[model samples]
Target: MSNFDYDLFVIGGGSGGVRAGRLAAELGAKVAIAEEYRVGGTCVIRGCVPKKLLVYGSRYSSAFADARNFGWTSDSLRFDWPTLIGNVRREVDRLNGVYTRTLEKAGVRIILDRAVLDDPHTVRLANGDAPISAKTILVATGGHPMIPKLPGSEHLISSNECFQLEELPASIAIVGAGYIGMEFASIFAGLGVQVTVIHRGDQVLRNFDADLRDGLAEAMRKRGIDIRINTETAGIEKVDGGYRVHFKRGDSLHAGLVMAATGRLPNTMGLGLDEAGVDLGWNGHVVVDEFSRSSVGNIYAVGDVTDRVNLTPVAIHEATAFAETVFNDQATPVDHMMIPTAVFSDPEIGTVGLSEESAREMGHVVDIYKIVFRPLRYTLAGRDEKMLMKLVVDMASDKVLGCHILGPDAAEIVQMAAIALKMGATKVQFDMTMALHPSAAEELVTLRHKWEAPTPMAGSDAAA
Candidate 1:
């Protein structure tokens, strides 16, 4: 065939690269995947896997409190950070081994070294291995947390550092109110740490359904979390006790640790993408076509490195499509629409499709169905927090355009909703379906009334 050492050379052994490598090798392609760190990439390492384990561990604190209302009594309660984190790390190690075994079983050559593009189809490994050539190259480097540039910013740590802390701090100040920051805020707060979340925006979870965004914040506040909105950070400085997060306007806040969870940038740097003629977007994202093909004929990219969706499942989805398209000769493009997503915050959030704001912006005359009530589980536990369930439907077609939820098991519930939305299920179909008794998700089918939007103020702009 082609004059190359391998059929595929995948850089960055994250989810996408691993999936592509395995699938391609399964199809009898000579595939090699390179990951500088451990395999399983961010999700299995410091991202979702470890973070979700921490979420599960953090919830025990609330569960213990709630158990008192359920007639369970315990005079002494203690949490060991070392035990939790150590167990989590062990699980991560297990997953890494699982992923490695998967690649090996699929006949993919795994390279434990950093790989850079020498040309469009040639790669150079950092461990002084001979340069390898392949017919096709893939970039799936993923991303890293973006720490803000300000004076004394060096004092700040990120989500990755959260897992590496030797001991849990007495208090933590998380900068940014995105999903990552809010999730950690929930974690630390649950673990009995005094936690403060600071964001420059006036609201938390920007771009989510407005009801869920505001409702979650209020519930978090009631749980004793200090959420500082419209509060800009000037810098971080070392203080006598710990660190002070200086505000751009008023009052500096002190904490044992300061974390910057503003956002993440694509890990497209220092990999010689430019030298290989691959285009990068504003945030070092590998610019690729719908087929994930780069400007260089045989070069392609996916996952957070391409910045499309940025979810681990999405990356795996894209990688699967890549393998099917390239090796199996099936021309499949990724479908980004109606993807369900979740935030592991205090009450949790799960949403699929468009928000009401997004639907309206797209010129959909939407009828919003929204309900807020304390969950049945919360009543017995004496938890005051409420659940928000909302649906955005196109008035013209009666088609359900969005589903948003904030409550326990929201993510689980939305997974079912995502299937409905993907199949273009209508409001009438949702209505006709019998709701399961005594479940929060049945609210999706039970909602009958349309929520009325508040009329615009006399001087304020709504038409504008």
Candidate 2:
């Protein structure tokens, strides 16, 4: 290994790559990380950080609207789009510098060029640049926004580009109903934009609990977002000042801007994975084992490139586990199950473990406990927003299989529930725990009645 130029070579200086590279270097291994883009990757540069900033900016609009109800009076309110965008860009740039400094402080060699695997142990940088060699190579190229191939798809902007818009559009038509799509919808709708969401699926968040799904849809609709479910975008054409979005549902909508939040694909293109013997999945995600090892014996992959969960925290966990496995000689594996996640959409959604539908599908007799009520804060503000909490339990084992929440601060509350679920807390254990009065989180442990019966398995394949 001493003869190799680097003990570990990381492609993509994203969350997982940076963590793995820095940790491996800290463990006395010669490490190098190559990134074609910014050091902080998607979460910092575009996805999480900027999105949250926009969400924060958009929330002020509602705050002002609801302020009058709370005895606070103000004249006409104004929002300067450039001011917010500039501030967010400055913050992102500062964070990017911080990530760079952190890597440098950890003695991880940082290369600012795209990397292509020349072989199992060698990677060639972009241009006719020199190739670097390492004993072990890790691919964490993350993912890119997947633009669907519609007739005039090129006319549509993506969520990535949407963040950098100079001026906020008066009306925006967002295509897709996933987290990203729904989040942008909430942001624009809150910001006084005439927002319309076109989703091909029957439900917005298909993976979340059904109760939360219905709750979020209702909340967004009440907020004045025109949500057209089971609708497909056929094409787009330039109209007067705005664009006409033709749909398969026999209707066309006009909007000043169109955003495509369809989904993201693994950023494996031009990486020379085939040339390096790394196998990719059907969706182009790099196939990796529990240990994050790719098909190439000396190479490994993690993060969005693997398309496993595709969350920043999951990537960080995998990176730490990768570091431990390689440098510390610990046989650690990333336990993806029970990974908690949150959507920052209005009336945010949070969940951990299995949904009732999924648990029953897995042959468990499940009992669902749920509650929906207006929070105490809304009473004072004269707002009608409702808080929803649910717990899915395996009846046979009495173990809490899942927890879901839809309300204000749902993310913060669900995180605590995630810890309990991680520790294998059962419904009885939750019941035994005392409730924190006047708190929405307490509902998780205080739900007394069984809300629904065991969901019958779909079709006649229950026995099979």
Candidate 3:
């Protein structure tokens, strides 16, 4: 055995773990990362990369239909599901190789085995007989999809399993209405699958502004997705050729395939977290402080394992901040404010900062501005699609509280607004900026009317 095993031992070769290991090694620390699965983890391997590719592939269906209205003619289009799946798999393999090489280039030793914490400072590899010692340990195992207990849920597929399907179904019934569920609904709808989305909640995307959520539901419905809100899946069964999904909202639905996109839970089972004196939340997520330091001083946790913002970018940010503070002695904390996020539905949704309802609940007098109009390109193309833009501002300070968009390139456009919000830009500053004519983004700077204002207090109440 080598005299020095490692200075930092990171479990789970995910975005946060890989980043932290590389950065620590670059700073002259002996770092090693252990991962039993693919090095690129969920985002590059199965989650974000493949999911977006499917979303892109599926969108061609609608594009082909919309082309006719744009004065274009084409023969009947055919989709080869296996070919698309093969291409996506190839891309994921290339990324996995890149991630592997990156760690070696950064002087990080890679251990291809599950890591079990023997102590706060020691980790034992599941495949190896020897135990590795380190000064600091990090848990970044991330999360796994949660499939609820239904009578015949075993017959249902998961988000992870969806990518490996050899053939695309003609129709599908999806359970849940979170981001994952809605994203899949949009993807399948675009791929020409008759999609039925059943959710147990009153509205989809419960975290987003109610207006945007409702608008997105309406848009998806218009695109031919059967959205069943406040609905519950009673059971599933194997039918003659496919699966039969029995659901109850106000009615029932039968589909070819039953998919559960309910949500994801942390992958913390059998990791020996309790044995190492680490505390976990009720849902099995490791508890950590602002700097991602666990209950055990020498142990740290980040990524989906912490149950913090589950976005890959957020985990990367947390990892970078943790490494800077712990190794470089730089006292930096991650700022969750104005963290822009996107939902890759048919009409993409993007937002930064607080929602209108959240702003009002925070005791701010909000001035809401909204614009719903078709873009110039759509106008020329003779398409019926309309884009929605909303701005929430503090009436007293004129500070821009939030920005939201639902339309094409919404993710790309909202990123710029996120930067402005991060820099503390106000409504006046946004309004004063020159507009880009005939562009969808120009709507941000040209909104002339306020949608609502907080009610003023009466004289007696104000005096009191």
Candidate 4:
């Protein structure tokens, strides 16, 4: 008989932890998962799932306007924030049930309370009667959004609170130009709210290709969202009409709400990682090896808590790789290279492989192929919105080092492109493929010009 209560004790019901626990149990090992809140964690409860639903809700204004240009008649458009929020909550609740039931059906015990490390191999539950022992313990507690320490910060909201508001604000000032901030800006603007975005950096989506970033910024400006770059918030105060956001340079703006999406930190505080001898990074993320094993041999971590690749699919992939290595005797290590990612802001963004700057810095002589033109749909609709398609190719090997797109369905197109990039597809191969005529994506295959190497690309200053 086994010496422990279970083979695995997973502390987190997030995507990574739950996937690990379920797969381990299915592999015939005893498993138990403990979660303090809802089982779906950030993605389902308050992150991607709810955020995407809001993105969809916010797009109807454009659709309504576009329909008229397409010769389709429509009724007066109205947006009900409460109704949308209520439905999104229902969907989240249903997903929570599904996650819980999945674990139970897999014969994995589910503990609906917080669990922390008592030692390398012991888990102490906040509300349970006794400590649980397991051969291995996995920490996948995920992360929470953080705001800067400014005067009257208590009045500011984070992404978590944005989901729970009773009513939509008439206007909002968002600090931080990351994907989260930009996404909220797009959503609020689409819903007819006055939106202002403030960022200390000169550009939004700082990690993306330069052209894509600037294109998105121009698009947001064209949509009437005011973007103030290289600015910092000094304080906030409740005012007569709403709130006043004071800037460091003695400027201010009045809005009904202020949101901070600066960044997220791992949810590892007070979980006893130190006492268990698990090493963490300066920013409090758990430090793990290639196999996702922590400093302590019997303890492991995955997902945002590890801070390697914070996307939900990457977390899920890491968990599957963890289970296979530990339980199936496959000794698998997750391949994070060339992982495709998307930003769901207005006009969207999808990218895979290295950015052109990174590729060049790595000492690759690159060939750039790019085009910016109004999509065919906008031609008939009489809109000036532009779509950008770019490819960064390693000239030496002829391999497509990166694919970046900015426009409607950019995320969808990039997801398919990721598969080809992962397979080491070459620029020649891309050219050999037939174009699906009259599609925004067909531009991917039809580009003919190779941009000269000596000509500095626009927006490259921010690339570094």
Candidate 5:
């Protein structure tokens, strides 16, 4: 028998930590999981789940507009912020209860307090409980949105605060152009608010493929968002009504609200990682091996705290692998490659595998197949919106390298494509597949011509 009180002690009741703890207990190991906040963690509490609900709420305005084209005489429509906010909060609370019950049912001790490392094998609870001893400890404290320090920065809010706003502002000035900033911009604009986006880069979504970055920016602008690229906020000042955001170019933007979605940093501070001698990255993310093992053999970490893949599903995957490796005696390593992802912005974005730039940078001559066309749904609605789909292939091997889509249901479409890509599907194989009739996805298998390079957009960084 082990000399410790528990076989596994998990810090942070986020997706990864909870999964590992529950799995270990089900596998006949003593487990205890601690969380200072709600059990559902960031994804359910403030990130993907709540955010997607808001996205769904925001889309109804467009749905109402399109309904007229379908001979529906619906009128007298309105949106109530309080109703949506209250509903989202209730859903979150329900999920929290579900997560807590799941742990209890699995026979994992649920400690509703913060757990910090006392040493390699010991953790101390904030509630003044006796120090918990375990044969293995896992850190999955996740991350928090980062707001940069500037003059009058106290007036700025992060994405975490966006959900709790007492009332939706008439106008909101977002202070970054990354996924969070762009997504919130789209959400607010869709709900009939004036939105302005400020970014230091030339375009938004900087890390995505160039086509997606440019296409999304154009589409957002067309939808009435004021996008100020190649710009940075110098400071903020409280005015009579709201806040005045001063820019580096000696200009100022006044809005009822200011939100900063600049980035996220691992929540590793004050966790006693330094005294425990676990290695961390420069950004304070716990450094772990492919198997999620830390420098100290018995101490491991997963999820955002490790900074490998910040997606919630990826964290769960790592946690499953860790449990199998440690408790089940089956060595497993989490694979992080070719994961499918989505951005729930206006129009949406879905992508998987290497981007064209990265594929070319790796010395592969690429064949690009791309199309921009209106979806069938827009034909009767008379909406001028267009969807973009592109495939990047390695010319020499005909291996599909990337699939990117920016349109309605892009996430659902790319999810299936990810399966084929993961299975090493090639250009010839995509062509050989039978097309489903009258579907946007059928376009994937029907395209034949290799795209000829078009003249680059003026002042654009995208390659031909």
Candidate 6:
């Protein structure tokens, strides 16, 4: 019918690429997806899935400690790293197979080789096969961890290599305060490892609500985590049994492990996108329009590789929108606003919609309703942990603008909250909804008064 090796050729068999390939096939397009390493990409292979498993594994110590208050007993509690890591690896391998099979079942050919653009319509493979030409090309190559070029940085492990570590370190010094670094800090600390979080910024989680950032820092410190803010790393030098991490200001920290969770950059190196005339942003991400069409009409990209939002779900959403727009003849623009996100750190954090700062900066007269109270679960365990619930509302329209939660089940609670917020539910609607008794989430609907900062004591610095 047409002169092309396939209708669509997708590079990167990650979640977004897989979804696009599968949907395009269902819409009657011949598709072939290429992956160099594994089918599940970063999230399933090295990121969210494996990391969440480690978070669950690390949390057992707290559960074991709380069992006493719950009237349960274990004479001896021990954790085996090999067993947990082995099982996690097996699960990851199984998921990789599952993803591979899903594409096969969807009638999309899965190519297990590195692929790059030979031209706008041709895909060159690393296997030395003849180049395959497609009517359209989609890139969903995802991203990789970014590390600074410092002396002896080779000794530092990234978030990607954490799962594959042969053994957990006795102590770890994390070099960033992002969600990734903080999550690992919680994990290592929960598992009785000495964890020190070093950050150059004044606080952790820079773009998060200030209260939540400060609250999390205090909670982590109370758990014996040494959070060194305003500290800069000069370089790293190997020592006898560990590493001596040089500080910028004439000091050093010694630890069994040093990790750089600085940030992530799109995986766009040597893919030949730039030379092919597909536009890339200054950050080296593929610049695409609302429907994911790149500068070249037949080229499209979706996922972290495009750097819009950079979440796995957001990538999948973009991919679906791409398939809908290109294949189904329906014009769909990605709505990049009001995405719910979570940090699975100790105590956890979940937030959606605009932050209070964002709402205020956008010239909305806002009402900030907040409550911080110890959860009922902590009462019996004698764990003095507090749960935070805050709602930012637009006074003029009574529309709920933001929802933020910090504490246990924060991710789950905010997921349900996001649905209501997405539906444009108002503050009055939240109030009209009945509160579930004795639940942390009930506080969201029941909160009535605006929060006011406590006045400084007469002799305090603020008063002075």
Query: Higher-lDDT candidate among 3 and 4?
Result: 4
| Candidate 2 clash pair list | none
Provide the lDDT at 57 for model 3.
Answer: 97
Predicted candidate 2 versus true structure: per-residue lDDT over 363-459, tens digit per residue: 9998888777777767767777877788999999999999999988989888988999999999999999987776777777677789856342222
Each model's Cα RMSD: 4.7, 5.4, 5.8, 3.8, 3.6, 4.0
Question: Local distance difference test, per candidate?
Answer: 0.91, 0.89, 0.87, 0.91, 0.90, 0.91
Q: Positional deviation of 244 in candidate 4, in angstroms?
A: 1.1
Model 5, span 341-415: residue lDDT tens: 999999899999888888988899999988777777887888888788889999999989999999999999999
Alpha-carbon runs more than 4 Å astray in model 1 = 453-464
Per-residue CA lDDT of model 1 for 1-464, tens digit only, reads: 77999999999888899999999999989999999999999999999999999999999988988898899999888899999999999999999999999999999999999999888888999999899999999999999999899999999999999889879999999999998999999999988899999999989999998888899999899988999999999999998989988999968999999999999999987898899888889888989899899888799898999998989999999999999999999998999899999999989999999999999999999999877777777677988777888999999999999999999999999999999999999999999999887778888897788988742221111111
- After superposition, the stretches of candidate 3 with alpha carbons farther than 4 Å from their true spots are 1-4, 69-71, 248-251, 452-464
Instruction: Give the clashing pairs for model 5.
Output: none
Q: How many pairs of residues in model 6 come into backbone collision? A: 0
Question: How does candidate 1 fare on TM-score?
Answer: 0.97
TM-score: the better of candidates 3 and 4? 4
Model 5 TM-score, all chains together: 0.97
How do all models score by TM-score?
0.97, 0.96, 0.95, 0.96, 0.97, 0.97
TM-score of 2: 0.96
Instruction: Report backbone clashes per prediction.
Output: 0, 0, 0, 0, 0, 0
